[model samples]
Target: MILPKNNYLKARNFILTNARMIERRLFEFHFENGTSEGVFHAVYAYRNSDGGFGHGMEPDTASPESQPLFGIMALETLDEVGYLTKEIILKDFMPYFKSITTEKGGIPWMFRPKSEYPCEEHFKTVKEWAAISTTAPLLGILEKYEIDIPWMKKAEQFVWSEFERIKEKHVFCYLCVSRWLTFLEHTKSQDKAKKTINNLKNWISNNGIICEDKTDEGWGLYGKPHGLNYAPSTKSILFSLFSKMTMESDIKELISRQKDDGRWDTWYGISEGTKLEWAGIQTLWVLKVLNNYGRIQY
Candidate 1:
């Protein structure tokens, strides 16, 4: 079954009314024959002078200064619109990433915001350690584009070493593990990446990370990840990891969870504006995934 045309129109109206400019452009680009250049212009407005992104690029913080988390979000935005180019990666993203990278050659989960703007409490808890959560997905995106930079080499080494260290312990957060899955899917180190994926597949299945059942109403919300969280597209490497039944059930749940206003609810955020912003982002994400899975009628 596919999402009805009326439902898609409702979502379009909701986004035009309530979403941020970035998300609105993304929605149009993906579904309404919007140009890549249009989306690129919207994304470029968030870039700081230091070549990083901030000023609420992520909607999680109002900080104007550059942050690692926002950098990743920027990359994701460009990737989604197919505007992630080598020029941008090297001249813009790489320099910023190098500036903020930890001594271990990986980006930290976040840094304390210098601005007085409101942000989530977790953003205040500074961790003085390199995080594979951020680094792995960055590497994965680089790998997907076949962009081989010297800095990326070091970051890849850091990611591989971290995987070796964490192999013994099957414990991992869904967010971090999700990034690792992306890395494994794209990294040239096929032998090692495959071995790690085999080892972690069961852990991903058994861990409280994925919402495997369709009847679980609270699956995607409240910071919980679901099947689409891990495998947003049929082409994702994580796609083959799940059974057909499991994937279908989660897709059904996703389709059924749209609110009356034609948006999905976001569970984590500080201000009401942040909540609405994330709702717009989440609604676009859901529609994109549904489209990729052939569940949306054009």
Candidate 2:
């Protein structure tokens, strides 16, 4: 089941040549024993004076302006490299979170980027509304470090209440469910988290959030996450929801999807400017997941 050495090398070359500096550093950190500081320095390049991130850190938009989505991506990168420290959270991040937060204490999924920046057309359509999609994961990551800021109380309240209200048909984005699971994983209320997770498992089982058939071309429907995208590893709470055969089929199909250039296909639309950048990011993620499943050899 190991990813062949040649395949790994091709992906390594693709990342080194085409990936953004941050993603390149991340690749090195994960596979080549590169230092976390290298990744941290690369990540810092994306930060704005407003204590937030931008400059296409997420690759969905090349906006230089600070954004909540970019901030989340930055946090995710830091978390991946084990640099999501208390000081980093407080000094580098909390202020930005405080600035963009709504009265409801949640951050919006996105803000309309200025017209000048090159971005996918979807950016123009995003509404500036608070999102459980954005807020829940942020809260979960913060709580992982036990960093209790004033902002978290309202956010925690919002996430908890929203999870309580969410129904099967009401769910649209599958990724949001992952965020909800993350919140449940770290929240102090273990009893509440367990109950909520059980409810979510039941809901997603019947909901269209998971694609059972691996061959379905619409698996990436409009760039939505796939079943494996939600549960990249066996450790994920959602992993058990899929049968062994389903997981294996999805993983086999995923490994086969790697292009001759060593990058996997993105389910979403991408502009010429972002195609390679997104590809590089997607390749790194695929390798990580394969490694997680013991499909890659050291």
lDDT of 1 by residue, 32-94 (tens): 899888898898888888888888887878888787877887887788778888777777888
- TM-score, per-candidate, Cα-based: 0.91, 0.92
Error of 2 at 120 (Å): 1.8
lDDT for each residue of candidate 2 in 212-235, tens digit (9 for 90 to 100): 555766554333446677678999
What C-alpha RMSD separates each model from the true structure? 2.3, 2.1
Model 1 CA deviation exceeding 4 Å by range: 167-175, 212-217
lDDT assessment of candidate 1: 0.80
* Model 2 spans with C-alpha error above 4 angstroms: 169-174, 217-225, 267-270
**How many residue pairs clash (N, CA or C atoms closer than 3 angstroms) in each of the candidate models, in the order given?**
0, 0
